[model samples]
Target chain A: MVAVATPPRGAKRKAKAPTAFGGYWRRNQLKLAPWLFLAPGAFFFALYVVAPILQSFQISLYEWDGLGTREYVGLRNYEELWWDDAFWTALRNNVVWLVLYLLAIPGGLFIALFLNQTVRGIRIYKSLFFFPFVISQVVVGLVFAWFYDPTFGLFNEILGVFGLGPVAVLGDPDYVTYGIIAAGLWPQTAYCMILYLTGLNAVDPEQIEAGRLDGAKGWRMLWYVVLPQLRPATFIAFVVTIIGALRSFDLVSVMTAGGPFGESRVLAYYMFEVALSEYGFRMGYGAAIAVVLFAIMMIYIAFFLTKMYRDEKGV
Target chain B: MPSITKTRLLAFAAATMLAGAAMPAIAQDEPLTGELRIFLDTSNPAPRAAMEGMIARFQEMHPDLDIETTIIDREAYKTQLRNFLSANAPDVATWHAGNRMAPYVEAGLLEDVSDLWDEEVSRDLASTKGSMTIDGKQWGVPYTYYQWGVYYREDLFEQYGIAEPATWDEFKAACQTLLDNDVKCVSIGTKFLWTAAGWFDYVNLRTNGYEFHMDLTAGRVPWTDERVRQTFANWRELIDMGAYIDNHTSYSWQEALPFMVQGDAAMYLMGNFVVAPLREAGLTDDQIGFFQFPSIDADLPMAEEAPTDTFHIPAQAQNKEAARAFLRYVVDAENQSIINAELGQLPVNSQATIEDDEFLNAGFEMLSSAQGLSQFFDRDAPAEMAKAGMEGFQEFMVRPDNLDAILERLERVRQRVY
Candidate 1:
């Protein structure tokens, strides 16, 4: 901003003058300032995120084995994906994940409401409730896996008390994906709870008090006054939970590795299994799978961005 | 390919001359240099300790050479090799033998190590050569492998007055007798589909002999072939008898061991690597005993499942010489003996011998005398086909009545994958 204000230092040589540096700096400084600030983040974003995405699209068109010469097979990889049963299973599982994952929002709000009251040891209770979110997803998956174990797990043990036989939740293809998603929900619900709790704290007590004066309390007060104020938090919660569902990789990976005949597969895990695993590296095929996942994420991202844009314009 | 072969041969000959002029210990004269990065999965404590010991010894030998090792969880390790091997490839990596290595070999990720095999491995390690060879060339050097057979609870058998079956009829009858007395006849964990493949390999190899099994695994034969159907038919009979531990699919191979250990179930058809876990589960040597998988189709030659592990230099590695040195050092019978001793597994090198433990003796005998050794099903078949085949196998185990449907589905996968 001050490049124009500073005079050139007493010129020693005419051509070697400081005018060039200052002139360029002054003329472009404002225009370049924001970009200069964004450079590091933009550079990384382009390098890691953008480049790999374009590369994945490119790789999907070829029969490349990660190494060696790539054969340009055009849409053959995508063509194969059309008939791929595992792809369908994974896609269906992802849809199920998305639909079920939204439960976290209401679930979180309910939890936040339950713990929102001024009770003794509430802070401790909040932290304890948010404990699952604090732990890594890998650990949560393992813990849940142990809980769901057929012979020795607590779930089965609990069932035994009811004179019910053990349930092989992880091993049965019918229940495997749901079993993993339930585990995913444990942590996800915790995360949404934290978001709602903070959102709840920022809620206007005056509006709540006004609502209470009109006989609004419990669910009605929360719906009419409290929730509207928590819109930003709800929006963030929805976005993250959707992403968590789509990126439902770790839980499936840690708990199942897409087992029981690929019944538990999400697109991400299926891609890994196809391109890597003990299977031959059909990188092109894997890339095709990734491209499909990216396409899906793009739809969500587009929807999210458009919704946010409209909200921003309105506000 | 010829042009590459010529250039590689020249480089290899130059390397050999350098080796000859150097000290007998390759690294001592060359003062080994460059990074020798090895990615392996040794999540099992014994094997992990054995690998660490091996690497420590390797470091002591080539103190000047920088070494990097990444040991990953076994399952995760399976998913990352293709990624790393393609980009910033490591100098050395561990891989399985048989059709499992075919994709990497075909994609040229693994260096052709036939020269190293001839110079160091082929003579003493002939038994393992078949597993490592692809298109008449060796892809890697196998260091360790163990036998797969019936691991039974001897105490349970004795208590129930059941004799160890040696023939197919006796095996079936034994399952019937055990079921009549309320004991699950077999304990298997098919949670990781490959464990189901273990059962498939034994049944296929026993019913159809090793050649047909290999053909089937190689995708040369259709899954609906009469022989394959017959194998499943036999498997169905066992399934119908409720011979296997219930809900086998819900447990990993390790998870299934508890039933056998607790004497609630009697037998496990598993690789000998499970010995460690079984012992960890508190079953003593006397309580746990092994028998060869019972013979079926008496005219068919006997074969055993022995999946071997190998080390290979990636084709793009910068440290070929150092990696070659590692391969040579690792395949040496003495080193193999030391490593496998700690691993509680048998070394692939012929001259490498295990101590006189009863199980080891039985395992060695079982593998050695077999007419052919089939790498367990997952290792024998291309990963894609193996995966589909095993899934079908597992599904069939659950619903034996779906035999035709399962075979048809497997045929579709085999057609596409092969």
Candidate 2:
């Protein structure tokens, strides 16, 4: 619209200097305004996010010990990662986390439905369900570590009532990853429950009533009417849960530190272990792991964005 | 390297001239006039106080020198060292001995301090010189070291009619007796993994002797070597007997103390540091006792594990003269005695007097008479190899059947690491 109203460039320059510049500004302000506002944020975004990402890629191609001179050994870090057993172990654990972490969505919806009713002391119950989410992930990790302790845990006591002997859940490599994930799921489920609870508050009662009249109740009502209305909430929950699963560092760190022979390592924790931990000084190898993790997140986000774009177009 | 050596030579010549000019106060002929920054990781209550006190005393001697000190949490300091050493270097920094200092030396982050190790200092601190030396030059000065051996429940051993084992067969026999009576022979926590390496170090040092053990840690010997397997085979006997407490991997070294304190386990193979905690937990001096790790081979001379803590000056430091004085003051026998008395540890200087604590005396005696002293596994080996080796040790303790696989995995890591 502004371009059509603007005079040709040479004709504008021939006018009075002050008026000509003012005229140019007036003509292009609409197009320039949004970009002008976005410049600061975009500059910082490039500096902090994009620049580091590119640097990580460059660093992954060299061999650096964080203290010594960087020797360029192109693709060697990545090549070593191919045969690295610890890398594979971490990758496998990440997949397990991703798959199991999604269970929180349904787990949350069920809890939300159970607590959605209006009853005396219902707020108390809702607050209690939300308590785990409010606490720090570090606290959650500590609580769960004690809960799964081999000698004196409540879990073992509960098992002892059934005459089963104690089991060292954290010490056993076969159960270490699962043990940490279950600890992770405690807070994640609470977080999702809060999301669903808010989504439930916004749910339209009229549509629910209409569905009931059409013989849709229980699971049917939820699937066809209630869930469709909660799509936005569900979408947010899915995105956060996936990210939480992928970025599962604190729980594994606080609970296990990728112990029992690195059986419980997620890629995030493994990268930290390889790059910065007391024994870890391999900066290039750590960068390679970071690059791989970044690639994974990029592919997932790209696919998600494309679907979201198409969905918006359809809408 | 040449520039550093030339600087050292110049400083030494200047010191000699100053000493000749003023014979009365030779050490202080050149009055120090600069800022000296020291970063310490003695964040624990006792050690922190000890270090602060030591620095304060040093500050008193040179009132004109501006001394700044920073104390970081012990674990956090391990990772922060590289950042500070390269970016914002202090004049003096605390670090470990042996291969733990290798990376810094190799990267030229640490200054060469061999000139400070004069004839008297060398003779007094001879035991730790091997640990502090990388290549032919010394990079740091050891202030303190402590022995690693079996700290056991004396009452429990006496109650079970068991004597302190002096030989391998007697050790097994005692473990068997303890096991028969439903007591775990040893209480070890391998959760952090390095505790497992402690066991590995003692066993390897005992079975194959010090040279082979050092070779193995240096990655000169393959993990799959027969001597290495022999060490593991000796360790397996204890493992097969269920000598160590069950589920050891679930607890940290501190967490394993309850077994010995409560008389559930007979022994704990740990450092001299364990004695302090055991006493604090209400175990009497009579109840807790120290013993050398029993001899595994009659023919091999005994070696001991004694990890030393040392201080180094950064190569990039601005105040080398003041820093050298601080290090020299640090290793003075009297300073070592004063600090180690408060530290409940052994002084690195032979002339220093030890506290009259029973366990400390025992450790001092054992370490003094030892043919060789090894810095514990994590300190001796490269960090990557130490990590992989310790993880394998923990795995082996839990599942002895996995020994072959663990050894092969360690071999792969060693090949890559070296």
Candidate 3:
């Protein structure tokens, strides 16, 4: 959007003795203004984000309690993580979150397609579907925790109708991660639905009409015609869902605090539990976990960036 | 120089008089001036009022001192402690005793208040002196503490024809009877992890005795040691019997209370703090009773869990003189009695009178006679070890079959932490 025009070299010399400083500023302001505008963001990005990442790398090499003098223990933390079962559990849960969380994409698309209609109460239905995303995640976690309560939860009550169980989903290690993931997927599905609903509004109607003329109906119509049109929306949904899955901390914190014996812990929550929680001040170990988590995130982020760059180049 | 000696002499006389009477004529000889900042974590309404009232009384004693008090949320205070201790330390700050203060002490954040723990103070507060001591120096002074035991519904025990069990077999029989009556034996919540640690502490203390438990926490003994395994075996009896409320991992300590309150569960092995909520939940003295966790080995001297809350001067404090004076005021037997009476806890000072309340008196009696007082599992163990140990306890409670795996995991963590 830069509209700044360069003055002709000859016209610059012919201009009536513009002050030396003013002339220099006029020449360089276009080149420098963008950098000037970017300074605050770059400064903060370095200070808050980049600096901490680098510091975490440094801190990961030491044995420090976040209080005492640092004792350099190079690579020991990571070596310990190799044998650490809790670390592996957290990493495994993150993978489970990544895989199960992707269900939100198709789940959202289905809801979006169902809701894309001319109906009297469609708006009300749409808002109702969007309600979960609007509330704080803490509230969502609390609601779902109560919903899964063994003795009084709705899940058990439904199970009781068939004489199944008053099983404690959060108390069972095998089910704890899945239970938290289900809680996470609720808001996430709502989020993706909103994205797809907006995408549906921008869909080209003529393409659908052409598909209909060719006898492309139902699943075939969605597959051959409408799906390509929603690629951008799907891309956005995938991006958010994957990142959301990776940084799944709040729900786990609120629901169980990595209970059922740390079964529900994601890397993010485990890192905090190790670093800042009352029972943990193992700064070096926590930093090692953070660095591993960062490395995992960087892989996805780098891939996304490269894909975005290629798309921008129309490749 | 002579005037300084006179001030010291006057302070010593005041301290001696405090040992005999209610309140010392404090700060009388040498008035403390400048600002004295006190940070407290007693954010709950009653303890907050008790502390503020105590500080107000201290302010009255030193009217010239500009006393500033900042009360932080109890949980938030824990993580924020390191930050403030290093960055913007107050003259004095409240903290817990035992290894909870170890990190701060090792980091040189806390002032060594060995001088404050004088001959008289040492003898008077001797019970908690070990908890406050680190590396042969006293880092702080404990103000209040409370006992941990099985708090049961008296009516339910009476209904089942059960007396307070004083032996392992009796405790098990009591649990079995309660279970046959369609009642859970104990209502524990391991959601926060420390509640399970409470059970571990008692079992270990009763199983192998206090010294072994302390050594195990200190990393001198391995987690997979036979003694440690025996402690787990004892705990497994309760778990295998399904004595605890169902789905306990889903509930907080407070959330587990309703089981006992509603008589769905017969007892709760918790700290004396549970008494307040029990009383508030409409349970009367007739309905509730306190008993020591029964002896697993009659040969072992009885040791009890009593987490002590303490105050320390930050090493970086600008007003160390005023802070030391404030600490003396805090541990004065009469002041401790007043504060703990309001707090519904036991005063650390030996001469301090227990509150007339049934629970407080029971806690006081139980603690006073106990051979050793543990600072709970979480406090006794190092921070990282405590987390791993407590998690293992929670796991063992849910899946008793996983005991071997859990002990191995804790052994690995214990190796790393130490």
Candidate 4:
């Protein structure tokens, strides 16, 4: 639609006097307010998170029992990791976890779309779908372990219904990693679904109606209009999914404990096994692994932050 | 000159007051008055109850002293103890006796109990005096020492017409018989991974002798040595014969215990602690039997794994004298007997009378007859070496084809450490 145009040059120009205090307040207050609000949180963040990161990095360079004189080994720990097969296995597992975990975003979005309707007792269905996320990871590990049990597990029972022999989901090296990942995805998918559900509620109805009038329906509608609107939610979902995958420690710790010959070990569990568990007190070596893991996580964090910066600048 | 004279007079008065206070401090060596905090393992109910009783007796004996004991699970105990000792250390905490104490000892975290051990308890437990001694000094006093070996089901053996194996050949034969009968001969859980290393150490000790076992763990002997290969060869034979439980890596020690308890498996090579759970699962004393791991070579010097649990006084202990007194009371025959009765462990003190408990008596008898006592694998070896070594053992057990690769990797780890 076109509107009538007005002449550009001779329209009345209005000039307002600048307030005397405007520059002073703008120069000083603008700078002061953001930092004042950030100070307490930033202090805590520096104390708890940032400081420990630096300390862990420092500790990784030395060989020390939790106590006793720390010997500076320079890069010996990192050097050893170059040939450490277990460390490589752990790193490979983490990559697999990262790649597989991204599936949760789409899976969660699908579930959220399915449950976004305002039917009777939809709230109950939503809560039921969200139930697994509320339970402790420890409990989730135990439940999945039982489910994967070859002898009397529900999974084996289901297999029996098809006249197939029971598969050792947790016991076999070929399947243990997949078994643990499945357990991780249970709650992760639920968490992502909740995020998408909220995002769907905030979707613009007018945009959807316009798309419908334009024959953008089903997959076409989802791809063109709906998903663009869900970008913020998807970004959050992807960020959290990546973090959850990288930090997949608890289920692995409780379920298989990086066993079936340590075939299931991710970096987090392997780091713990090295540092703390009966494995040994190789704190320096463990910290080296932790640093490597932190470096990998930093790449993804930087990418996400850059995207967010661009989006904010556009706003 | 007048200010100097006044300062001299004040110094004289202060010295007089200090001397007065020192006299009372020496005179009232009465029992320490304040709370004595103890951190102990709470996984098992019996020992916690027994400890509470002992604490009550200590409280009654010295009305001025109060004891606050916190019992945590074994895993949590390690984490909490490490944290506590690093920060607000307790007066006395339970710990393992060997290399586990070495780190704390080096850090000056443990109180030097050399004087106490020399004057009081050393005479009572002369046989175990060496166990508590580290370097040139005694760091702590062990209350109980437990032997590790195979515990088998008598009923399963009887059902399969298998006799208790007295030698390596007989052991293999018995394992074959069990396998033929569709029963697994060994039930092992490698989820913790250290349990598998226990078998490795025992096999190595039996195959090569105590000195070589020590040398290998100490990183002196190459892991690919012929003697080490022989141990793996024997282990490979057992695996080939389908002797161990299927999918051991998926199971914890507790989970594998059921196989033995349910008669699905014939034997469990574990520490004496497994007896409590075995008995709890409704297996009678008659249904189970304990044996030293059968000898691989009859001429080898036999070394049984006998890890000891001890309590040490922290250097930061507020009441050092009272802590010493409490340690003394714990090792005394009367208290040792009570502890052993409840704890199902052999007493560290030889003079402490053995009770009627069958398991403890068997453990005591076995320890007494053993040619030598070797600390458990994880305890005897440095922490780094033990982790690599145990993982190697697990890998070898699962896939015999990987033995050479595993041992080579372990050798590389050992070389790097040295």
In model 3, how large is the Cα lDDT of residue A98? Answer: 95
**Top candidate (TM-score):** 2
Listed in order, each prediction's TM-score against the native is 0.86, 0.91, 0.90, 0.90
Query: Which window of 10 residues has the lowest lDDT sum in candidate 1 chain B?
Result: B1-10
User: Can you write out model 4's per-residue Cα lDDT over B19-129, one digit (the tens) per residue?
Assistant: 454322233456566556677764677677777888888888888766766676776576556656665566788988877777778888888898877654778878767
CA error at residue B14 for candidate 1, angstroms: 24
lDDT of 1 at B121: 65
Candidate 1 docking class: medium
| Higher-ranked by TM-score: 2 or 3 | 2
Per-residue lDDT over A1-315 for candidate 4, one digit per residue giving the tens place of the 0 to 100 score: 234465345333311325667556656997888999999999999999999899889989999766667899999999988998988888998998999888899999999999999899999999999999999999999999999887779999999999996887888878888889999899999999999999998999999999999989899999999999999899899999999999999999889878877789999998888787654577898899999999999999999899999989999
Stretches > 4 Å off in candidate 2: A1-29, A120-124, B1-37, B59-69, B318-322
Provide per-model DockQ scores.
0.49, 0.62, 0.60, 0.39
Report the C-alpha lDDT of model 1 over A66-135, residue by residue, as the tens digit: 6578899999889889977779999999999999999999999899989999999999999999999999
Q: Write the number of the candidate with greater DockQ, choosing between 2 and 3.
A: 2
The DockQ value obtained for model 1 is 0.49
- Clashes per candidate, residues 3 or more apart or on different chains: 0, 0, 0, 0
Total clashing pairs in model 4? 0
* Per-residue accuracy of model 1 over B68-97 as CA lDDT, tens digit each: 777777876676677667766667889888
Question: Candidate 3, after superposition: displacement of residue A113 in Å?
Answer: 2.0
For candidate 4, the docking band is: acceptable
Worst 10 residues of 1 chain A by lDDT: A9-18
